[model samples]
Target: MNATRIGAGDRPRLYVSTTDTTDVTGDLDYIAIEHAINGEPVSLTTAEKVYTAQLLDSRGLTPTAIGRLIGSDPVTIRGWKTNGWQPAPTGRPHKASEAGRERAA
Candidate 1:
């Protein structure tokens, strides 16, 4: 599935209203994605993820740079780019805390 555009007059970004793990039957609005970079676990709403990806893209920041900015893996950041803010696929199993964030609802 592709992304859905967010509100107007805000930074242009796209979010997944449905995903591989989520569909119209569920509402995941309260769920937040967190990634520990350095020491802090940065929390981000789905919109934040989209904005983040676009922000980095607009600035021409590579995945390495964006990974450091959000405390995620560079490969994961690249996954976000390809997945378009759905979730950063680590290409490996995620820890318990890292689950759910991979797919937005």
Candidate 2:
């Protein structure tokens, strides 16, 4: 059997900002990026998060699809989508964007 391995080239290079908004190379989990920075006050900025969400919304995709499209974790995409601004729903796996996705395909 041939085993597939993810080398350094296959992994994503994440850059978390410092107190002055400078990019620093690090491998922080995609989902915890906002918590690490915002919770700890590490140069607070929502530019990337918001931008990613906008792209996903414009493309009419769910967090899973957008995550795959941008090489980000699906949970992180969901985090950006429902981040503090949006209201949470009780139902699981919301299909609000699913219809649009089918149309796009």
Pick the TM-score winner.
1
Clash counts for all predictions:
1, 0
User: Can you list the residue pairs that collide in candidate 2?
Assistant: none
Q: Which portions of model 2 show Cα errors greater than 4 Å?
A: 1-46, 84-105
- The lDDT per prediction is 0.52, 0.48
The estimated TM-scores of all candidates read: 0.38, 0.31
Q: For residues 12-59, write the lDDT of model 2, one tens digit per residue.
A: 443333353333443223333433322222322344444544544564
Task: Name every residue pair that clashes in candidate 1.
Answer: 37-71
Worst 10 residues of 1 by lDDT: 30-39
lDDT of 1 at 73: 76
